[model samples]
Structure formats: C-alpha cells, structure tokens
Target: MELGLAGRRALVTGAGKGIGRSTVQALCAAGVRVVAVSRTQADLDSLVSECSGVEPVCVDLADWEATERALSSVGPVDLLVNNAGVALLQPFLEVTKEAYDMSFDVNLRAVIQVSQIVAKSMIARGVPGAIVNVSSQASQRALANHGVYCSTKGALDMLTKVMALELGPHKIRVNAVNPTVVMTLMGKANWSDPQKAKVLLDRIPLGKFAEVENVVDAILFLLSDRSGMTTGSALPVEGGFLAT
Candidate 1:
C-alpha cells in the first residue's frame, strides 16, 4: 500500500485537467514529487495550487523542441507518464492530412520523444524507473468513426513493447494502460452528449464509462515498485469492455 513512492520524481504530460490532473494528484498523494506539463499556464497553476507536491511546467507536448528543452531543465525523472493525447473523430474519407498529423504528433510522436528524453536521463543516472503510456481500448477494438485516433493509439501500444525491450537493459520498465471511455472533460464534451453518451455506454459491459480515478489507480500501480516485474504489457482497465 505504501507504493514505496516517497521522494520519487515523476513527470506527467497533459497534467492540466481530466485524467492527467487526477494522475498528478494521485502521485502527489503517494508522496511523489510531480512535474506536471500542459500547454495552459492557468490550468497548470491551478493544478499546482490544488496538489501540494506538484511542480507545474507549461510546455506543449506537440512542440517537440520546447518539450525537450523544458524537460532538460528538470533532470532525472523516476517516472514518466505519457498521458497527453488528442482525438479527432471523422470518417476516413473526411479525415484530412492535418487531422491525421495532429493526432500522430500529440498522441504517438510526443510519447516517443518524451519517453526518449526522460528515459535517457533515467538510464544515465542508473536509476530503475518506469514509464506508463496512456493507451485506449481503441488500440485493440475498432469503432466506426475512430480510425485516426485508434491507429495512433494502436501504434503507441506497439511502441510501449519496443521501448520496454530497448530500455530493459537499463532497468527502465515500459508499460501501458488501455482504458475504455473515461468520464473526463474530453469524454463529457465528446462522448457524453445525450444520444452519444447512451450509445457509447451501451458497448461497455459494465454499462458505464470509467471514472478518472480508475485510470489513475492503474497508472500508479504500473509506476510503483509493486509492479516491478511488469514491462512490455498492455494492462487493460476497460470495465470489461474487452471481455464482452
């Protein structure tokens, strides 16, 4: 239960709100010092105010150079949570190059870049750290209009395995948490609309979407020493959606 997380330094992207915000709070509660990154200064400030052990860093993960520079300033991260992502829903024919590029940039490429930067620091310091990528049920199950988002997350799931193999030599573990629809602001704004919410919830065996806490708890488990043997695995917190 201790999680043995005291004094550990964590970096969580997309920490401004929703699941990222909850993750920052959860890590802080476990006595970990968190460097929270997001594009919004105000939201980051608010998160810092609400969470005692969090240090807010406002850097857009989509901006590769800026993210690397900002991360360089905060060296030696023990845990890296690649939680920042974006989803744009559209028919395959309607999906433009810009949308596809944005999805890849934020959801897939950003994870790869940030993990490389943070993992290097961990390896250089000879620290056995953990990296948890926030994947989705979409990574495994395809939805009608989720082509672009699903593809990016599917790629991320694969990246998790490859990173685990590459980083294991340095004692850095890489894993992923694939959750079904979580009741975050993004979920509310997009899927929680009256008709859409009903349709979405129907697919879940639990007959409800996941709470932010559910995803946060899974992430913390992967980050902790309790899951020391866990690497290159996609742990599903899917409310049994995958089972059904």
Candidate 2:
C-alpha cells in the first residue's frame, strides 16, 4: 500500500546511526525529504553521501538553546522523529544527579522541545503532521541498573499521550515505538556477554533480539497515513517481551 508519504518533509533526530539512520533511509525510500540531525558532523556527512534527499543538521540535543536555535532554521516539516537519546546504566541507589539530568535532558526534554518546535510550525502552516518518539521496552519494564534510562523513557511515554491529546484537534498525531534490544553497534558490544544476552533473550518469546530495521518499520507505519487513526499509543516492537 502506498503510505501517502511522497513529497512530505520529515525531521529525524539521532539520524547518524542505528535505528535513526535506518529510519532516515526508510523515509527517503518512501519518497520523503528528510532532515537528519545529530551532533557528529562526520556521521551527518556520511549519511548525506549514502542517501539522497537528506539534509544534515549537526546539533547536540543535550544543549537546549543550541537545539532550539538549530531547529528554528529547519523551516517546516510534516513529520518529526524524536529519536535522539542516551542510555546511562546506573543502579537506582547509585544514580547521580548528573546522570539523571543528562538522561532526562536528551531522552525526555529534547523530545518535548523538538516536538514543540515542529508542532508549532505544523499548526502555523495548517499542516497535519506526525511525531514518532523512539522509546524503549525499558520504559514499561523495570530493568535493573537502568534506573535513569528507564525513568526518562517512561516519562517520554507519558509525554506522548499528553502531546496526542493536545495536538489531535490540530490533526497532528503523536506516538511512540518501544523496541527491545536492537543489534546496533552499541547493542552488539553491550550484549556480547553470552550470559547477559541469554538472560535478556529468555524474556522475549521470539528467542531473539530486535534489529534496527524492525524499529524503523514500526516508526514508518506510525508516521504514514496507514496509521492515521493511531495516536497516544506506545507500539511495542519488543518481540513479545512485554507480553510475557
């Protein structure tokens, strides 16, 4: 089915690598002009070389003022993917203010700021847009040593609902994709421990972890007209980890 996404302009955060990079490629494949945002200039440059119709914007989402200023120049976008996030593993008892702040700043606050800027533009131009936040399975599940990361994601899930409620009248949809352990470079390195990998995989009924493409597909569905009626929902692409 045609997703009715042709000619639409989209902005994807964390677009340099992993699921974010895949999402940008998928959007381009669907005939969407994409604005890719990441802090690394090299990654952005590489992405532009690899994909057509992608405009790169290098801005650290952790910096509120800089992000706001950078986004101001992006003009208008019909879709926004709040995918830039950092996961810092810290036990609940050992979590520090610095770590907590960083997690929330990137994962939760950046989503809010970016969505706000994009939604404002959408509303101003009377363009009904879609916003998909890249959340994690850790949001709904309590994972040990992921206190700060989990909390930020949980807040993001809630933020999605609130955004949906407020933006519905304007025809701007908001949703989230919560994925299980995806085999990105970081994921491969972290889950390389057989014992650790087995422990996590046991919880997933599929007996495996997720791939970047899996999450990208889910995100595309949410952004496309195919999921027109979907909003304020956390679509889990977690291989049934949440099910069991």
Candidate 3:
C-alpha cells in the first residue's frame, strides 16, 4: 500500500548506522526528505552520498544544551524518530553512577528534549505530525546485565505514552516500536555467539530474531497516514519473543 509519505519531511536521530540508517534509507525510498542526526560526521557524509535529499547534522545528544541548539535548525518536520540510545550493560550490583547517568541521559532524557523541541514546532506550525520512539523488548522484560539499559528503556516507554496523550490534542500522534534482537552490524557482533543466539531463538516462537527491515517497516507504517489513528501504543517487532 502507498504510505502517502511522498513530499513529507522527517528527522531521524542516530541516523549514522544500524536501524537508524535503514530508517533514513526507507524514508527516502518512500519519497520523503530526511534530516539525519548523529554524532559522527563521517557516517553522515556517507549517508548523504548514499541518499538524496538528506541533510545530515552531527550532534552528540548527551549534551542537553548542544542537542537543543543543533535541533533548532531542523525546523518543523512531519515525522520524528527518536532512535539514538546507549546500552552500557552491567549487572545491577556493578552499575555505577556514571553508567546509570549515561544510560538515562542518552536513552531517555535526549528523547524528551528532541521530541519536545520537534513537537513544539509542529504544534506552532499547525502540522499534524507523527513521532515513533525506538524502544526495546528489554524494557518490558528483564535481561541479565542490562539493569541500567533496561531501566532507561522502561522509562522511555512511559514517556512515549505521556507524549502521545499530551500531543494528541495537537493532532500529533506518538508511538513506539519495541524490537527484539535485530540483525544490524552491531547486533551481529554482539550476538555472534552460537549458543547465545540459539538461546534467544528458542524463546521466540517464530524461532528467529528481527531484522532492521522489520523494524523499519513497522516504523514507516506508524509514520504514514495508514496509522493515522495509532497513538500511545508500543508495537512489538519481536518475532514472538514476548509471547513465551
């Protein structure tokens, strides 16, 4: 089905690589102009070379003030994807204040800052926008050595609902995509262990992990007119991992 996204504009955070990069490519393919934000200039350069009509902005979201300044130039967009996140895995007992702060700042706080800025613009411009937050199954379920990461994701999930509720009056839709082990370059490196992969595969009733495309498709649908009424929902692209 046509996504009805042609001529629309979108801003995708963490667009340098992995799922974020794929989302930018998919949006461009759907005929949308994208503003891709990341921390790496080289990756942004590569993205601009690969995709047309893309504007790349390099900003480390960890710095609150800098994130605000960098995103101010983006103007109002039809879609926003808060996909940048950091997962410094450590046992609950071993998690330090620095690790906890880093996870919360990057995963949850940055999302609030970016979404607020974008949503304010959309409301002011009278544009009915869509926002898709990239969360994880780990948010809803506990994972070993993922204490800080999981906590941040869980908080993000709650934030998604609140944003949806408040933004709905402004005709802005907000939702989240919770994905299981997606097969991105980083994911491959992290889950390359055969035994670990099998253990995860067994938990998924579909007997497989997710791909970047799967999550991208879900997000595009949410951003498109197709999901015009979807809001405050967390759509899982987990391949039945949460079912078992």
Candidate 4:
C-alpha cells in the first residue's frame, strides 16, 4: 500500500474543507510536502494548525488572473489535485447565467488553467507527475436541481481524458476520482433525513454513501506509482451507485 509519494510536493486546491482537507492530511501523513490553496484565510490557518507544514495560499480559483498569480510562483508541483469546485444546484429550467459562469469557471476553467501551469512545470523539469481531478458521479447520472453542476463535471471528465492523452508521453498522468456523496460533516447533515436519503441510497448497490477516507484512499493510489498504469481514467469510488 506504499504510495511511494513521500518527498514529492503536491498542490491541492479547495484545501479548506471536506475531501480536500482530508486529502491534504493524508498526503502530509505520507510525508509529502503540500501546497494547500483555499480562498478562506481562516480555513488555511486552521489546516496548517492541524497539519503543520502545509504551505497555504489564499486565492479564489474562480478569478482567472488571481489564480494564475497565486500559482505561478508555487515552483514545480510534482502532483496536482484540482479539487476546488462549487455545486450551484438549480433546476434545468431555472439555471442562471451567473451560476453557470461560476460553476464552469471553478469546476472546469480553473482546472485547465491550473493544470496548464503544473503540466508545463512537470514537462520542463522532466517530472513524471500525476494529476487527480475531483469529479462527481453526478457527471454520469442526473440529479434533480444539478444541471449546471453536472455539466461542469461532465466536461471535467472529458478534460481529464484529453489531458492524459497529451501528457502521457511526458509521463504526466492525469485522471479523475469521481465520487458519490462523500459523508463529510455537511454531507451527513444534508443526508441525515432517511426519507430523503433513501431516494438515492436505494440506487446504490452498496446501500451506503462514501466516506472522505474512501475517496482519499482512491486518490492517493492514483497519484502514486501503484497506479502507474492508470491514466486517462475516471476511477469511481461511488459505492456501486453507478452500477445500479
């Protein structure tokens, strides 16, 4: 189970909370140097308090110029996790331009922009780095009031494939970890109601949602040499939701 990720520096977006925070902690435990990026300064402070050596950067990924400026100087990231994303749930008929723009900016556009920076560095330094995009099962299956969110993730999966295709020659593997609802604090609160949760829970053959650790484990595997043969793949940690 050794990921062989020790000593490799990684940059993880949306490191303030949920899966991003857990991923940072896992990487730090594996002896990987981490660059944690989140817009909220307080979250960054708290994360560093917990993990100690995390290099925290406060920047909103939705801002094109700001993201570039913040990441331009991080200096040769050996691993990249494009985990910063927003879920602006809206019915297909009610989807607005603002929601669409913000969702696309953070979910898809920022991924391309960030990866461009990291992949360039990897190629230049001859680093056979890996990139893990945090996509969702919502990309494959439709959810009520998640039209815009689904579109962004669907695009993200395609982007992951194309990135892997081009970056494979450089030994820069790009893949996505598509998870179902991970049981973060917020997720638990949202799904605590059995009647509401049953609607989706019944669809999952495993009859359970995933935990942050579940998704994190998958991500580390993909980022490590253990998954060296995996590239341009969207590995699902969705607890058999996709199967049913």
Which tens-of-lDDT digit does each residue in 1-244 have in candidate 1?
Answer: 7689889999999999899999998889888899999999999888988987678888888888998888887877999999999988999879999999899999999998998889888877888999999999999998888899999999999999999999999999999999988988877777757787777677778888888999998999999999999999999988788887
Evaluation by lDDT, superior candidate among 1 and 4: 4
Better of 1 and 2 by lDDT: 2
Q: TM-scores of the models, in the given order? A: 0.96, 0.98, 0.98, 0.98
Cα error of candidate 2 at position 83, Å? 0.4
Give me the runs in candidate 1 sitting further than 4 Å from their true place: none
In candidate 4, where is summed lDDT lowest over 10 consecutive residues?
Answer: 182-191
Model 2 lDDT-worst window of ten: 1-10
Clash list (residue pairs), candidate 3: none
C-alpha lDDT of candidate 3 relative to the true structure: 0.94
Per-model lDDT: 0.90, 0.94, 0.94, 0.94
Question: Candidate 3 has what TM-score?
Answer: 0.98
Q: lDDT tens digits, residues 1-244, model 4?
A: 6778999999999999999999999999999999999999999999999998999999999999999999999997999999999988888999999999999999999999999999999899986999999999998998999999999999999999999999999999999999999899878987899998999999999999999999999999999999999999999998899988
Candidate 3 worst ten-residue window by lDDT: 67-76
Question: Local error of candidate 3 at 45, Å?
Answer: 0.4
Q: Please, what are the lDDT tens digits per residue for candidate 3 over residues 3-105?
A: 9999999999999999999999999998999999999999999999999789999999999999989988787699999999988988888989999888899
Top-lDDT structure, candidate number: 4
